[model samples]
Every structure is written in structure tokens, then in C-alpha cells.
Target: MREKLLGLVALDRLPHACVLESGTAEERMALAKDLAKALVCKSGVDRPCNTCDACRKADSGNHPDILYVGPENGRKTISVETVRNMRDNAYVLPNEADRKVYIIDPADTMQDYAQNALLKILEEPPTYATFLLLCTTKASLLPTVLSRTAVYSLSPVVGADQSDGQLEEAKGLAAELAKALASGSETSLLAATSAFEKKYELLPLVLEQLGLILRDALVAGSGGEQMISGAGKSAGSLSARYSNAQLLTMVEAVEDITTALALHANKNLTLSRLVSRLAAGM
Candidate 1:
């Protein structure tokens, strides 16, 4: 994936602006920093060689040519004043590198006025200047801003779930969830309970895989099955207790918690509450 993105930001091309989205803000920031290093590397290699002086400065956030625009005072949103400052810096010649790189983090958190303020610079960006916007809220961005920049979405890592030769069993679980969702029959509910017991007997350390399965179920419209996305055998055994709608609501609630966790919310309590909610909803 890094190689693919490096190709997109081709050094041969001199300069360009882009927006890269990732599953987590941390991952997005890491990618942006690496790209900044690559842009200013004196060696002009595909990636920055950390041994080089330019690379070291960039790694330390001391690179004169790389500017960052983010919330001041750890605020949640970037202000229009910050955007104005970024625009002023955009016109200046590179201090120590061939190109100037601007990275905007949590671009989605920028207020409407701030985004509009950024539009003028994006429309007629300085020569050899590059802008990269890292955001998770693609829908919230101004359409004009999106139109000027190349956009890329980083998908949630697949197979991040822990299942030991359980793909077949998972498929079976999918079918069961699908059936339960289709019919409000008592047998369907009982089957869901049984599936929870058989498939997720021991929960995986990483819940992402299970979460993905639940998301897939939602996409497939199998609401009944989605409720059991995080359930272990202990919980699955009583799946019959939940209605299809109730299970779906539980899944949605969990997804909301997942979003909160990604934003650096209290993970332990949030997860425990999500689990408890799922159990209760069922």
C-alpha cells in the first residue's frame, strides 16, 4: 500500500495535492509524515532515507519546507485563522527543499468557513507546492475542495479477525443470520443462539475481524446475524432472546462505539459497555 501511494506521489511529477483517508487518524498521520519526508529527501529516492539530513529533519518535524495545519491548543476543529496562515506560508519559496509540503490533519474537523478559506489556495496553488488533506469524513468536505485533490480511502484491514480455520464456520454463521433476519420464527432465533455457541466459543483478541463480519452482515441486510458479530459461544447460546431489529440496533450501537474508540475515547469502558449492551439487547 505504501508503494502504491508512493507511486501516486511521483517525484518525477514534481508536485501535486492529494487527500488520503485511512481507517484510523494515527495511521493517516503516519502516512502523511512519510510522504513529507519523501518529498524533501535530498537523495530524491522513492522513500526518504532516514540517514540523510533532510530526512532526519522531516522525521523530527523540523523541516522548513513542510508545514502542518491542525487545531491550535488541542482544539477539536481547525480555525479559519489557521487556514489563512497556511495560505500565507504557501506563497513563500522553499527554505531548504525542492518543494513545499502542506499536510492538513483531521481535515474533516475543519469548520465550513475554514474549508472555504482553503479553497482559494487549492484552486491556484503555488508552483512546486503540494497539499495533502487527511480526513475520515469524506461526505462532509466541500465538493469543490474534493474536486481539486486526488482522493484515496484506506480500507479496514481484512482478516484482522482471529478465526482458526473458521472461514467455513463463519459462512455458516452468515447463512444462519441471514435466515433469522428473513424470518421472525422462533426456530431462527434458536438457531442464532446455537451459532453463537458453536462459532465464537472463544472471542478473538482483536475484535476488528468480528466487527467487519458484522458490517458485512449489515451490508447484506442480515440484521439478525449482525447482533452476534461479537458474541462468543456463551452469548450465542441464548441468541433466541433477541429480535432481529433489536440485534441490528445492538450492532449499530457497537459500530458507534468503534468510531468513538478510533477518536481516542476511553476504550476499556466503551468496549465493556458495548458488550454489556449487546448482551442486554439480546
Candidate 2:
């Protein structure tokens, strides 16, 4: 994920707005700061070249063009007024560098009104401005907010020792399901999904892992090299087998089932619906 992100920076292809998610607070903040530094760095392509004045200023948190916005006055939530203020500041020309970077930490804490305020600017950000929204989960933000920005997960795939038996089993099931989806065989897909028929307890983990696989597929299909899901071979096959649109549909289907299961919906019925959705996507 780091390589892919830096590659985008080097290629000057990073999106104007992005959501960086799924890591510890410190990890996410560090990454956001590094990316901000890179954006404002004077070195072309080789950004954040530590020796540059911009990089030095960024490292010291003294860069005028790199701003950090979050809850103020010990408040737990960011208010709409605060977001509007940031939006207004975003329109101003950069003070030092060619670009302005705003790192919005704890973006998940923003209420609906605050997010809508942010969304207004996100919809039409200044050409010189870039916004990085940091959160533990992208689901905490509104769908409209998600649609307007690129999303990247900072969570590394769990290692074998870090995973319990159930998680390991879920990973296997997820890999099988990914391959099944790529195969476009309803029987194969059903067989892969059958593992979750009565195992309500493992359904969430399985769906989560499966979602990661789909994320990998999207990255792979877009010509990205790194696979954060650790299912590189399956992701490759999926990328080769499906178009971006189909993969997005599959992703939404997984998300819907995961959300339903979270709300204490009937596991069997949700699982059935998930299978139908996947098959339809194919």
C-alpha cells in the first residue's frame, strides 16, 4: 500500500481528495503527514526530499501550505462551522509551496452536517488543494463523501500467528469465494458460500476478508502492483476476469450483506441474498 501510494505521488496521479483508513491513529497520522510533505515538497517526482526547504518545514510542522484540521477546544466532534472555515481557507492560494495539503484527522467523528459542509468543498476543491481524511473505518463517513474521494486502507493483512483459527478459516473461505466469483460458475460459487450456511459467528469475518479481496481486485485491475489482502494470485485472477464495474457491484453486495448481518438480520437469509447478488454480478 505504501509503495502504491508513493508511486501515485511520483506519477503525479494522486487524487485531489482521499480517505486514508483502517490503521491505528498514530499510523494513520504519520502516513497523512508524510503524504502532505510529499505533496508540498519542491522536488519533482522525488518528493519529500528531506533536504528541501518545504520538506524541512513540513517535518517541523511549520509548513504554511500544509494544514492540520480537527476537532477544536477539546471537542469530540468537528462542527459544521469548523468545516466551513476549512473550506474557506482551502480556496486561498498556497503560502509556500505549489500545492496546499489539508490533513483532517479523526474525520470519522464529523457529524452529518459537518460532513456535508466538507462535501461541498470536496465536490469542487481548488486545483491547488488536496484533502486527506483520516479514519479508522471508511464506513463511518457518508456514502456521498466516500464517492467523491479515493479510499485507501492502511491495515496490513493479518499474519498467520496474529490470526486465530476462525480468522484463518475465514481467510481461506474468502480466497475460495474470490476465485469462485472469478470463475463465473454458480455451482462453484454456491459451494464456496456454503461454508457460511449455518456459521453465523464467522460470517462477519468471512465477509470482511472477502471485501479485502475485492479491494485488491480493484487495485489490480487498475494496474496497481501491491496486494494488501495477501491473496495476490486470487486477486490477479479476479482482475483478469472481471471489469471494474462488475467488481464494484460485487463489493457493494458484500458491503450490503455485512451491514445487514451487523444489524442482527437473519444470517441464513442474508447469506442467500449475498450469493444471489454475487451471481447476478457475474
Candidate 3:
């Protein structure tokens, strides 16, 4: 996650608009916030220091220069009116900072007309303005808008299973699941889960791999294991501090992060905290 944060900050340095796509809601939201902080930050570092006034304001959700829009009320889609508000508000110069940052969270939820309206601004955004569109999939965005923005696809962490011959299916499924989970729409998750269930006949083995991932996480948690050897380990002393149930619960949390990662959920808070929890248990 630190690696991702650094890379994103570097990308922010470039004078270009970005459409950050994540697999889970948590990951997407986290990425969006990170980008916003980077944009408005006064630290002038690769990543937002999270200590400066600009970073604090952004983190506190009151940065005058930063505008966040998302699904309003019961409506799943961001209204045309909201986009208009963005269009109108964007013209105003920054109040507190050099750059005005507009973050459209779950940008994919914008209705077609709203997206079309937003397209004009991205087509020729004013100077001193930065736009960050957060989405789970680039396909949901208008091509016109997409063409004008730099798209960075944040993929799930995929690797071999803990034991056995290579599970090619798991790897492929992991990629697909990552994309679906990152997608901001709930409908996408339901559809993807269903599709994954239908296409992959190796549920038990996949579950086993998940179990292995948990074990590695546990071993890694206690610092009992020197290093993870790709999928399987040779032989090592087992960390007996945690019970089977606790280990299982930890795995469940990891799976939650997995889902969150897919949905573009908050990455720094979720991923970093997850690691922290594992280390704590150790």
C-alpha cells in the first residue's frame, strides 16, 4: 500500500488529470483521498506529509479548494445538478491554495447526461485546477471524458497459492475479482460474484488457497517465518500463539480487505490498519 501511495504521488506531480480505478470501494476512496492530499499538500514532497495544514484540511474534509461529489440522498447516481454545481464552482479561483482540487467519488455513478455535462470541463479544464475522477471501472466513464483523463488501473495483489501445483484458475480469478470488487457499483459486485461462482468449479481448492494466505499472514504476523517463498514454504517453526479460530478470523478480515480492495475502498486506512492488526495479534 505504501508502494502504491508513493507511485500515485509521483503520478500526481505530472500535469495531467487522473482517473484512478480500483477494485473495491475502500481502495478507490483511499486512492481518491490520497490523490486529493497530494494535490493540495504544501509539503511539496512525493507523498503528502499528512502533517501540514493543507494535508490536515484535506484530511478533515474542509479544504476550501477541494470539492467532493458523490451519490446524493437515495439516488445512486450523481445528479446533473451536482455536475453543474461543479462546473459553476470550478470557475471560482482557489480560496486557500494554489490548486483547486475536485474529486468526484464513484464517478462511474454519474448519469449519462451528467457525465456528458462534466465532459466539457475535462475537455478543457482551466489552469490551476485539478480533477480526480474515482471509479471502479473505466468502461463506465464516457469515452470523451476518459480520453481526456489519464487512467491508472489499480489491480489486486495476485500470486500463487500456498501449496501445490500452480492454480492458474485462481490467478485468473483473482484478477477478475479484483476488477469487479474495485468497481464502485454494488450491482457490479453481485454480478461478478455470481459469474465467478459459475465459471470457477474449483471452489474448495480456492478456499484452500485462501486458508494458505491466512497461514502465511499469520506466520508473517508473528515474524516466525523469515520470508514467504512465493506460494509454499519449505519448513519452519509454527507460531502457536494464535488459535485456529483467531487465524481464521484474521483471514476473514483479509478477505474483507480483498473485497474492499475491489470496491475501491479506503486503502491507507484499511490496508495499513489491516497490517497493523496482524502485527498486533502477533
Candidate 4:
């Protein structure tokens, strides 16, 4: 992830909008700030040069052109009115930097109306504007919003506040399953899926772990293995066994299964179909 971001900074090919999928709020915010700072940096050679004034301002969270929008007043969701204001403000000229960057923390917190309202600006954002949508659950977001943005999923940052212990455990099991699926270990795959019977609720976490594992494998196949963490063995093995296209298919399959589970799809059937697809792909 750092390598990809650094390459973007080097090539000045950063997307107009991006989705950072991360469970840890602290990691999300830190990445957002780093990306924002890099976008507005004067030197522009290496991202977020700590010595730069723009980087300093971003570190202080007071950059006039670097704005943050989120749910307010203990509200559970972001209001449409706030999105409306953001749409209006997006057209405004940057105060100091060459670009205006807006970071929306937990963008999945936006209600349907708010998400719809924000979609307009995302589609035809101002030339000098950029948007960063931080989210834990991509399933809650509109496909339109997702299609118009670059999506990057990250694992929980080490030592950060990790309250979801079950999810972590699920990921461990999922990692083993992913390796088994890639290696065509039918017995292991069946056994792993059987574990889901005792805790079907962790299906989402399992699917997410599989997606991340496949993503890393594809990256490794494409020469970015250094970007992967926690799933390096599975990624390395999968990359050697599958082509990039095949890895991508598995990633999409995992994401689809995850979204289906999130929407209350049949667990047994989904698990069966998922394993079938994984097996067939290999």
C-alpha cells in the first residue's frame, strides 16, 4: 500500500477520489492525512515531506484547503444537509494549496440521501478537488459511488485499538482457507468452511480476509508483494499457482460473497458456491 501510494506520488497519477477500507479508525485517519498532505505538497517529489509547510499544516489538521466532513453532534449518520454543503463547497477555489481535498471519515456512515447527494460531486468533481472516502463497510455504499472511486482495503494497523477480536480470529481461519483453496486442498477447504457453522456471523470477516489475500497475490504477481502484510505466505503461494486474471476473479468472488453475506444471503449455499468457484478457478 505504501509502495503504491509512493508510486502515485512519484508519477502524479493520484486519483480524484479514493476509498480507504480499513477497520481501524486511527490508521484510516493517518493515511488520509498523509495522502492529503502529499497531494498539496509543494515539492511533490516524495509524498508528505515533513519539512514542507503544507505537510506541517496537514499534520496540524488546520489546512484551509484540506477539509474533513463527518457525522456531527453524536449523530449515527452523516446528514444530507452536510453533503449538500460539501457539494456546494467543492466548487470553491482552494485557499492556499493548488488543490482542495475533502476527507470523509467513515463514509459508510452517510445515509442513502447523503450518499446520493455526494455522488454528484464525485462524478464531476472540480479539476482542483479531490475526495477521500474512509469506510469500514463498503457494502453499505452505493455502487455508483464505489465505481467512481479507487478502492484500497487495509488490514487493521498493528497495536491500534482492535476491539473486534472475533473478526481477527476469523481472518486467521480465512487465511488458512485461502491457502487451501489456492492449493486445491479439498479436505482442508471443507474443514475450514465447516468451522463457519459454529460462527456463520464471521462469514463477512472470512470473505474480507480472502479478498485481501487474493489482492495481495495479484499484487505479488504484478510485482508488488512488499505491499502485502499478514497474508504473505498465502499470497506468495497463490501468486505462483494462479495468473493475475485468475487471482482477480477470486478477489471479486470473495467480495461478492462478502456483500451477499452482508445482505443476509443463505450461508450454506454461499459457502458452497464460494468453495466451488475457488476450486474451479484453480
Candidate 5:
């Protein structure tokens, strides 16, 4: 993902709008800053040359051309007025760099109206401006908002212990689930998910791994590199078999089930709902 972003920077092919999805808020913000720095870096081609003035300012979090937008004054949600203000400022020229970059952290917190306001600028962004929307999951953002931006999913770092026997079992189950999903067979899907009915403790890990597979599928479908080594074949088949919307729906389903499990919801019911959702979507 770093290489892909850098290549885009070197080629001056950064998208006007982008969505950075990750499970960790810090990871999303970190990458957003790196991309912003690369975009505003003074060195042409060899961007984010840490020695450049832009890179230095970005490192210090004082770059004028790079702006961070979010809920203001302890507010939980970003308001339409705030987004409108951002739109107004987006028209202004950059303070220093050749391009102006706006980083909207926790973009998923925006309400529908606020997102609509953001959509206006996304639809007709300034040629010299770039927008980076950071969120924990793409499902939080509206489909219309997602359609206008290039989406990048970042993998979270797993502990060494997670790479043990349990992880392997989770990966196997996740692969089966992915292939079953792509096969469009309800019985296959149920049989695949049945493994989770008894092993509730492993369901989270299985769902997490499944999310990665779907993420890889989305990336592969968009012509980016796949992240999961063991799931590459499954990801490739999923990419070829499902539309982006379908894959995204499955991703959202995984997220939903994960959240439900985290809340101590009924395990069997949650797993059943997931299967039903996937089957209905298909």
C-alpha cells in the first residue's frame, strides 16, 4: 500500500478524493498525514523527501497547505456548516505547496446532511486540491460518498501469538467462507458458517480474517496488490466473482457481526444473521 501510494505520488496521479479505511484510528491518521506530506512535498518525483521544508512542517504538524477537519469543540458529529466552511476554503489557493490537502479524520462521524455538503466538493473538487477521508470502516460512509473516491484498506498489525494454530484454523474457515460466498450457494455458505456455531470463541478471529479477505478482494478488483498471502487465491476469485458493491456489502456484514459479537450478542443468532445477510445479498 505504501509503494502504491508513493507510485501514485511519483506519477502525480493522486486521486482528487480518497478513503483510507483501517481498524485503527491512529493508522488511518498516520497514513493520511504521510500521503498529505507526499502531496505537498517540494521535491517533485522524490516526494516526502524528509529533508524538504514541506516534509519538515508536515512532521511538525504545522503545514499550512495541509488542513485537518473534524468535529469542533467537543462535538460528536461534523456539522454541515463545518463541511460548507471546508468547501469554501477549498476554493482558496494553497498557502505554500503546489497542492492543498484536506484530511477529514473520523469522516464516518459526519451526518447525512454534512456528507451531502462534502459530496458537492467531491463532485467538483479544485484541480489543485486533494481530500483524504479517514474512517475505521468504509461502511460508515454513504455509498454515494464512497463512489467518488478511491478506497484503500490498511491491514492492522497482528501479534506473533495470533499467527499460531488458532490463527491457521481461523484462516481456513475464512477461506471456506469466502469461496462459499463467491459460489452463491446458500447451503455452502451455511455449511461454511456452521463451524462457528460451536466455536464461538474463534468467531471473532475468523470474522477478522474474513474481513481481510474481502478487503483484499476489493483492492485486487481495483488493480491494487492483495495484502493477505494465504487468502490471495480466495481474494482473486472473490474479486472476479463479485461486484465492488457486493464485496463492500460482505465487508459491512463482517463488521456488523464483529460488532455484535463484541457487544456479547447471541452467538448463534448473530452467525445465522450473517449467513442470511450474505445469502440475501447474493
Candidate 6:
């Protein structure tokens, strides 16, 4: 992915509005930072050369040409005012770098009006401006907003040291868990549940995977891209077996169970009840 993106940089063919989606927020931000470095790097060869002053400043988070925009203090969504500000700033010339990069992490959280404000600029961006929007899912944004951008879907990574087999195994487990719940197969669900389900420290991660499965199912049913890793087959199956409402109910059950887990509720009971609710929904 880096090679392709950097190749675009080398060819001077970077898109004005690019949307990259990933299953995890951390990966999106990390990739956004790397892309920002490439946009601002001054090296004639191996763009985004980490040793260059531009790359060093980008690493240090003080690059003048790069901007980070997201939710304001205590806010859930990116405000329209923020989008408006970006619209005005995008027209200005870069401070020093050849291109000015705006990085918006978790772009799925942008409010409707905020997205509208951005759509205008995206349609007619300045030659020196580049916008990188990192999101977990593209379904949340308007079709008009997505039409003007180049979209990229990133695969999930558990850890640097984790092998590909282990990562695929984890995604397969999550897919099976979601498929069983949607199919109302209690036996399948029981077999898929791991002992880690009972560990409070691991509950959040477990629930997040389940939630992603259901959300991806909905996205698949609607002909949108899925954000969950290695769950494409399961998502296809669930989308065929369930309606939008059913998928939403399953997602809500998983979310509720997650909230219960976060509140320090009994894991055994909560997990059991969550399964029951999911089966009933199915």
C-alpha cells in the first residue's frame, strides 16, 4: 500500500481527497501520519525520507503544512465550524512544503452538515492541497462525499509480532461467533466462545470484534464495504440470512453487552444473556 501511495507521489498524481478505511483507529492514524510525511518530504528520491528535515518535523508533530482535525473538546462529532475552517484554509498556499495535508482521523464521525461543508472544498480543491480522511467505515459518509474521493480499505493487524496465521484465526473466530448468533445456532456459539470471554481485561476487545461483524453484515447487505477484518464470507452469509433490522438488533445486543462489561458487570451472566438476546433476534 505504501509503495502504491508513494508511487503516486513520485508521479505527482496524488488525489485531492483520499479516504482510507481501516478496522482499527490506531492503524488509520499511523497510516495518515506516514502519508502526511510523504506529502511534505522534500527529498528528490525515496519520498518521505525519514532523515529529511520535513520528515523529522512531521515525526515530531510540528510540521506547518500538515493539519490534524477531529472532534473538539468533549464533542462526539466534528463540528460544522471545523469543516468551514478547513474549507477556508485549504485555499491558502502551503507554508513551506510542496503540498498542504489535512489529516482527519475517524472521518466516519463527521456530522452531515460538516460533511456537506467539506464536500464543496473536495470538489474543487486547490492544487497545493491534499486531504486524507481516515475512517473505520465508508458507509457513514454521504454518497456525494465519497464520490469525490479515492477510497482505500486497509487490512487489520493484531500486532507487529503476531503471525499472519494467528491474525486470520482471530478474525475467523469472530466471524463464526457472528454467524452463529445470526443463525441462532446455540451449539455453534458455545463452541466459538473462548475462555478469554470471561476475562474482564479481554472483554472489550472481544465485544468490539463481534460488533464489527454485525456492522459489516449490515454494510454488506446494503452493498457497501465491510470494515471488519477477514469477515467477508461471514458478512455475506449474515447479510443473506437476515434483514437490516435483524442485523441492527444483533449489533445493539453486542453493544449493550459491551457496555455491561465496561460497567464491571458479571461476565458469565452478561455473555449468556447476550447470546440469548442474539438468538431471539435471529
TM-score of each: 0.54, 0.59, 0.53, 0.57, 0.57, 0.55
lDDT digits (tens) for residues 25-113 of candidate 1: 88888888888887888864334656789999998889999998899987889999999999998999999998899999889988889
Model 5 weakest lDDT span, ten residues long: 2-11
Q: Please give the RMSD to the true structure for each candidate, in Å.
A: 15.7, 7.2, 16.0, 7.8, 9.6, 13.9
Off by over 4 Å in 6: 156-282
Per-residue lDDT for 113-215 in model 6, tens only? 8999998899888988999998888888899999899877676445555645554555556666876775667777766665456444555555656666666
Q: After superposition, which runs of candidate 3 have C-alpha atoms over 4 Å from their true positions? A: 1-12, 156-282
The residue pairs in collision within model 5 are none
Those runs of model 5 whose alpha carbons end farther than 4 Å from true positions after fitting are 156-282
What C-alpha lDDT does candidate 5 achieve relative to the native structure?
0.83
The candidate maximizing lDDT is 2
Q: How much does candidate 1 score in TM-score?
A: 0.54
Q: For model 6, what is the error of residue 176's alpha carbon versus the real structure, in angstroms, after optimal superposition? A: 38
**Per-residue lDDT value at 173 in model 3:** 45
Evaluate all candidate structures by whole-model CA lDDT and list the values in order: 0.63, 0.84, 0.61, 0.77, 0.83, 0.75
Q: How accurate is candidate 2 locally (lDDT)?
A: 0.84
What is the lDDT, from 0 to 100, of the residue 139 in candidate 4? 78
- TM-score of candidate 6 to 2 decimals: 0.55
